[model samples]
Target: MDGIEDGAQPKKKKGMVMTIAAIAIVSVVGAGGGWFLGGMLAPEPLSSDEARVLEEAKATIKAREAAEAAHEAAPAGGEHGDAKKDDKDGLPKASTEANGVLQLDPITTNLSYPTENWIRLELALLFQGKPDVAMAEQIHDDVAAYLRTVSLQQIEGPRGFQYLRDDIQERVDLRSEGRVTNVIFRTFVVQ
Candidate 1:
């Protein structure tokens, strides 16, 4: 009986030791699994300020894209060709006496006073049909010569220039035998 009891004691001790080893193995596996999961699920760390700035940058980019799309989709007449075409067609076409506007290059003249300055004067003639090319060249030459004769003092002020323009129109009308009715200035430069 004594021998049996001692043997049973040894068996009980071995069972307890096995149970402890199993529990330890389970704890180690659980810890390793938790570490792996943490690595997979963890988010990148960012300061609050940095996060706010990133959000604002994203918003700004989206807003600019939206604005650009809107601008492209809508018609902007001021910057487009349709507006210019409309302006040209909207003007009342000149009558049989004056069919359309004739654009002419300005005659540039050098002034000999105070400073070495230059003046440019443009002219637009209203006439019926396309005038003969030779006649137009002759008219241009005659007008340029006439402009060369004008004194600097006579065309110094706005009123003086206006009168000069009117006088030039009248002279052109006379030269063309009433065929040219009006003159419009396309560009004027005094520098």
Candidate 2:
């Protein structure tokens, strides 16, 4: 009786192990097929406008970085015997508008609900015609104000973030009165 029980145990264990191996093999094959099909289906052609926009966004970021570096290097004292510095105004000297694209300075703010958490965002705008610096500034201020009111959880997950972007875009559209065409979110980080 003991020998028969031990023999049956081995058969049961062998069957279970074989079933697991079969399931793993099936899963791997199914995943491989899905990956191949997804790649084949994902081939997309870029339009001329998209290409131009990507180039413009790159240029805007470079210009912004250059301006920030220049701003930092110059001495603060205007009354010095040295030649008076340019851009006495607070705004950075970077070219904010170029090739129908407008880049605004980065915005950093603390969330209202969770005062500890902070958000930093960088943005670029694509205008209908030429970029409007004044309206862009207005939009920046509006975004800062809106961000101050947002709770940390409001922009927690992917869906929450999508909603946040849509809300901001809608606000910009209304404030710009359609002069501003599209809002390009360059960077978003919450810490």
lDDT (Cα) of model 2: 0.82
Candidate 2 structure quality by residue, lDDT tens digits, 105-181: 78978889767567889888888877888988999999999999999889999999999999999999999999887
The 10-residue segment with the lowest total lDDT in model 2: 84-93
- TM-scores, all models, native as reference: 0.44, 0.52
Model 1 C-alpha lDDT per residue in residues 46-68, reported as the tens digit of each score: 68997787688668757966875
Best by lDDT: 2
Q: Which runs in model 1 stand beyond 4 Å of their true positions?
A: 1-98, 111-115
Candidate 1 achieves a global lDDT of 0.68
